[model samples]
Target: MESVFTILVLLTTVGLSGFVTRVIALKLPLPLIQILLGCVLAWPGFSLHVTFDPEFFMMLFIPPLLFADAWRIPKREFFRQRGAILALALGLALVTVPVIGYSVHALIPAIPLSVAFALAAVLAPTDAVALSGIAGKGAIPSNLRHILEGEALMNDASGLVALRFAIAAAMTGVFSLRHAFLSFVMIAVGGLAIGAAIGWLSIVLSSWFKKRASDEDPAAGVIMMLLLPFAAYLSAERAGCSGILAAVAAGMMMNYQSLRADMSIVTRLRIRGTWGMIEFVFNGMTFILLGLQLPHIIGSALIAAEAQGYTHMVVLIGYVLLVLMMLHLLRFGWMWGLRWLARRRRQRNATDLAVSGWRPLIIMTLGGVRGAVTLAGALSLPILLPDGMPFPGREMAIFIASGTILCSLLVAIVGLPMVLHGVSGKEDGLAAEERYARIEAAQAAIRALAETHDQIKVGLDESATVRVADCFARVMDLYRRHLEVLGADQTADEMARLDDQVDIKLRTRGLQAQRAELLRLRRRQKINDETLNKLLAEIDLAEAALFTRSRTV
Candidate 1:
């Protein structure tokens, strides 16, 4: 009962934070607001005690969130930017682990080198979710955002795997670099292959069910879809592989499967809306949980520091600041070196690079914000070694990880807006692509209508054929006008624009009338609730379509 109550409270808090963020005039990011609310909830008067379980948290929240991100990211852009993503995700992890490990050890000799490396490993993965919340929608250039998103998706596994090895080294007091490398390669490859196979198998089974089942309802399919990430994660972990990468691979496979599958519109929309809500709730809960843990972690660390002959909280804070500074410095230098090499290669007529400018480099550096994963990894550290001795620097590591997450969020919240101000995001040819798609679809519709009309006219009486032809002509003219609008001269363009305006107005007004009549019928008992609801839904969808088209035009 207590566990259930705690969950209810957390859910309510998550929902209320969304409301508060909107109601407040400060315009703070949602994650920041949720974290603050969490801190408030952690007060003694609240009596809100919840245990933190790292493995469960990762399994519960991380897989679906990562899957959603992978599913949504443009596959072409992800592949196109693979080189940069791998460099940051894998190569940078390799670099950051050692550099940060040595730095942490040098600063606090009390921490063993292995433990320091563990801390560094956990901090390696960036939180693109937090970055997006801080940066706001469409704030970063699209290309840079893709790269950042890809890096975040891939680095989680790398970081966690490194942490696992670090923990092993700390426990056994022995380490093998070559063996770790081989294990990482096997784990990563095996996870990817397993995830892809599972995803493909799910698609095949779904298709089989669609053929065998009589009902068209999408509930069963939606439920299966929701379970996919968890299944992938658990399966890979059981196989001694990287579950994070498995979830990511499964998500990527989902994108490909969706493109090829002939799914109902209802199923697509339902899946989209469901996942949107899941992403929101999970992300909010993750941050709030972080906030809930902060006071205890920091207070305990401060007390431990005092016992160790350090008297001030500032000393611990200084360590966080110093570590954060080193991270940014390393990120900036790495990116700058990549840019220089690309520039030199471009001079040799090799190829053009996607990311350019020092400002973007700075934005990317600041965008590398840490979040829940780092804290979870830190907290997951074992409390006792094989010799029955307490784990060295566990409290300090957790405190530093928590502090780093907070500080990184604060820094990006303050720094990103300043850097992004007055900077224009580069156009990624979306408008041109949209225009081309519209023209092609319109042409196809015209062709299909013409063919259908010919078939129908051949079997009808002259009068019926005339009526049928008239109906088809009216629908076909709409498509023709759309095509004309797409490829119009200056004068024709003005006329087409006016026609679109008048058409949109008529359609919107008609939809509004339909909705009004629907409600009126229900009020007068002229229609059953089910009938009214079904009709109203159609009307609402029409209105939404009109609104979307108006905005697009």
Candidate 2:
């Protein structure tokens, strides 16, 4: 009982810290702060004896996080940037490993080339969580954001495969480029096939379930979406393929199909909220748990370095900083070269839209912040090699990887906003377009309502029809009056948007009144719990619809 209570308190504290991040993020980046807080809480004085198990950690965290990211991303746009994404995910990661490995071997003569390459592979995958945060709110260009997201997802697979090959070569003293290539292709393709199959199965099963269930069974739909990522990941892993790729592919497939499905608006809203909250909780838990593991890792690393006869821990720290510098240099050079090549290709092809400027290259370079994936890879390293000797440079690999993660994170947290300043967000243009469309949609809705008035009146009784007509008349009046205030030449989309906001405010006033009345009835005991809940639900649904409609503008 005491153990249970202690855990409850600890988790609550961690969750509360996550919530506090939202408020403090304006001053310090939420990701940096959360990680720092985690490290601090890992102190022995806290009596937190956390253990690190790589396989278990990956199984717990990777699937849902990747799925949420993929689900939210725009499928069509992501595929449009598929070329750039593939280059970064596969080509750039492949380049980074050898270059980083070469540098590591040069610095630390004790570490074998293969082991260093393993370290390189550990660092190869960009931390998806950090990338997502750095690109949060889409402060960077949309095209670059899409590439970063896609690269982060796919490179986890590529880097892991490379890690496997590096370890094999280290253990056996034999390496074959051809075998590695074939193996990578098999793993990637297999994962994709498995994931797509599972995704289609999920959709079919969901359709079958919905056919039998009543309209109120949104839980059934939400459960299906929640189960999909785990199914993709586990099945792929069981098949000896890449679980990360499986989860990502499954998410994309599900997202594409869900977009085309004729799902009810309420179910869609519920699923969005449900999945959104789940992702938020999962991210917070991952970082907080990562913090709990810091103490043991840092201590072991220092001991290992001490055994090497280093005078001060500063020597190990120096190696970490050097590795970090190498990573940044390699990343910048790769992105710049690729961007230049892309521009040359575009010019040769005579494309109308001029190629993107250097900002994307700079942003992508700066955005190479590492996060949970790097940590997982480093921790996942086998404690002993095939010959039973302590894994060569294993401690250094973990330490270097952790230091690189912090460096990348601090750089992103401090640098992203500076680079983003003075740059315009595309949100302005999108919001404007959305507003114009919403105005047209409202006009159409009003006309349709008028046309169906006769049928609506015939179906309803006297009092009900009168109330319905009064509501319809008011809504129509609002739209007509709002549009009359707009310009003739569409001079400003913002004008219509502001007017739409005004319409939302007017609708919200009624919702507020309904809410107050519902609460009052409950307080007076004039209604049973079920009756009060039903009335409150109707009001809640109305407000939700109104909120969604307003946001369309």
Candidate 3:
């Protein structure tokens, strides 16, 4: 009960801090703010020792987060960049482990090669949420942004797999190249199979439920949507496969399946909003937990080291930074190798190939943002190895992981701003691309509504005919104005004003008519209160979407 209560309070507090970060607008990043605040809360006087269980944390956080990310990514873009994402996510990670592992072992002889590889694997998973978040604000190219996001999404499984094998090697004192390679292939393929089966079942089930669903009950569809990620993860784990990849694959399937589900627009919108908040809390709480543990780990390490005549805080931090630098160097070299490989194959459109010169490479290396995953993996290390002895360099390992994570984040949050100042072309290009995409999307809706309007026109009375025409006409006009604005040479502020004006006109004429008709139907007892409310809610959502689109591009 206490733990639950603590979590609730922390989430509430963390949420407020996030809000505060937005309100303040130009200070530190929210993750850093949360981490710093967490450090303060971790002060001895504060009795909040927020603990975590590795299995529980992975189960609770990883699936939903990865699922949401995978679901949201553009399916076409993801697959198109599949080779690049895989190379960086899996290939680079595989390389990073041995390279960083060797570096760590060489830098600090006290830490075993196996443990160093474990730490390296932990750090290899770049949770680029923060980088991607700010990248949307401008600076990073759209193609680059896709690469970052894709790599982040797929790399979790690779990192986890690496960590697993590294741990196994550590415990048994044996590292088998062929055996590990076979295991990787098995886990990945098996996870995909399981996830695909689950995904197909979900789609079929959701469709059947939709046939019987109503607004109030919705045939338990939303519940199933929430349950699917957990189902994928658990099932995959049981089958000794990559649960992370399973959840991701399931999410990717659900993304398209959702289009086929006969769900209300309002319901879908509600799901997005709910998941948004859930992710906020999950990521926030994890980062806060990380900060809360950091000081304690450092203190513990220092005390133990002092007694044993080992290195203290300053030396440990320097060593961690050194290893961090090596990770960047390794990434730099791998990136060049990728560039060379892409050139050899004439892969012009690949993200890494598109990246010219060493400047982007350096930026990308620095931009590889590591966060809660690194810290969590480090903290989750077993207290004792398979031999029932204390894990080697446990304290130092935690410190190094924490420090490296901080550096990665800081490099992105602090350094990227300075680097990106010299670069703004991507922002403008991204905006134009978005405007074009939005126009295309709206045009699609326009086509659908036109077909619907035409089909129903022949059977309807004059009043219904006019209403049907207006439905399609209003949407078509919205798209027209959107395309017009994109071609205009007006300032952003002027364009925004035009958007607002059009949004108001559309809401006042189209959505308002729908609401008025619904009220009239209710008054005449032609429609029940429930049906009227549902219709009204749908109108409200349409109005929301109209204004929302205006803001997005």
Instruction: Return the TM-score for candidate 2, rounded to 2 decimals.
Output: 0.90
Of the two candidates 1 and 3, the one with more favorable lDDT, higher being better, is: 1
Q: What's model 1's lDDT at 42?
A: 89
lDDT of 1 by residue, 441-546 (tens): 8988888998998988897898999899889988887787777778858788778777887898998998898889889989999999999888887887778778
Better of 1 and 2 by lDDT: 1
Q: How are the candidates ranked when ordered by lDDT, highest leading?
A: 1, 3, 2
My TM-score estimates for the predictions, one after another, are: 0.95, 0.90, 0.86
Query: Per-prediction RMSD in angstroms?
Result: 2.1, 3.3, 4.7
Model 3: residues with Cα > 4 Å off, grouped in runs: 23-26, 133-139, 214-216, 308-311, 422-539
Q: For each of the candidates, give the backbone clash count.
A: 0, 0, 0
Note the Cα lDDT for every prediction shown.
0.89, 0.78, 0.79
Q: Per-residue lDDT of 331-392 in model 3, one digit per residue for the tens?
A: 87887788888887788776544557766776677778887777778877778987789998
**Model number with the top lDDT:** 1
Q: Write the per-residue lDDT of candidate 2 for residues 425-477, one digit (tens) a residue.
A: 56565667766986787689778878877677887788999998998788677
Candidate achieving the largest TM-score:
1
Model 2 worst lDDT run, 10 consecutive residues: 346-355
